[model samples]
Target: MFKNSPYTIYGITALILIILLIILFSYLGLNLYIISYLISINLVTFLYYGFDKLIAGFESVRIPELVLHSLALAGGSPAGLLAQKLFRHKTIKTSFQMTYWAIVILQIILILWLSF
Candidate 1:
């Protein structure tokens, strides 16, 4: 049981340590807002690209076409919008373009909501 479970055991231990650290920091009254924001930024980029690939299918080089509005709903819209526009890979397709812009608008609204 222990042989094949080594990697899983190590991973679980690391995850527990991280959770403990988070709990300790919060207990100590440390604010994690900034750290959370930075982590979100990084995750957004990765998620956007991943979503794109998922939506496009395996054969398409343009990446999968994930639901952009949904991603934006989850705080990854802005990154997805920027990446799609800059890369110009999925910009021309009617479905992708439309959904991408729709997500952009949604993100703007979310930003406003968060700010106020």
Candidate 2:
């Protein structure tokens, strides 16, 4: 029903991520502060993506790629991926995608190292 609006995908992805996070945290007994931080960072990253998309439509000054990568590295890569897909932004840029995936991989490695 939301064929005309990209927001449907964004909302769905956010909801699913939230649910999954809750479940995973419950299973792992992770700290509340980390959960809160992830939620806040992801929200900010999603807004950044939305803002960047808006500016792109108008040919206005855009948010820097470094800033975007920083946010993703700061625990927002899942949100970044969702935003990229939902907004159809930055997905076509191979360099950006490569860097983004690298950030994701690094984060995964960090998480694994810390979990042990």
Candidate 3:
């Protein structure tokens, strides 16, 4: 299913890293609320990608880019990246990718800042 895209490898690697982080945090007795929020948002973001892909096939009204970015900023980026690669949705648009990566970078900064 990965086909010829290197992005598919990167996406899966990111997902694995996220899952490992989650497990480590849980083992360290970190905040359950945060963990739950991450899981929820990721699931929602993944589903949104799938939904958007399905609609796109039919030329239906699409989900707003802002909403997708918002979800990524809210801790769903791993899922977003995975979905983008796996579903091949929203991966070809330069504008969307730029915004999405911006969100991811911002989130990483915020996360590092918060950890300190």
User: After superposition, which runs of candidate 3 have C-alpha atoms over 4 Å from their true positions?
Assistant: 1-31
- Return the TM-score for each candidate structure: 0.45, 0.71, 0.70
- The sequence of per-residue lDDT tens digits that candidate 3 reaches over residues 1-116 is 65644345434444565566667667777769577558856887888788878888686656767667877887889999999999999999999999999998898888899999
- Relative to the true structure, how large is the alpha-carbon lDDT of every model? 0.54, 0.79, 0.78
Q: For candidate 2, what is the TM-score? A: 0.71
The clash number for model 3 is 0
Candidate 3: Cα lDDT at 46: 89
Q: Flag the better candidate by lDDT, 2 or 3.
A: 2
> Top lDDT: which candidate number?
2
TM-score of 3: 0.70
Q: For candidate 2, write residues 16-83 as lDDT tens digits.
A: 65567656666676668668568766877888798889889786656778778877987889999999
Ranking by TM-score: 2, 3, 1
Which candidate, 1 or 3, has the higher lDDT? 3
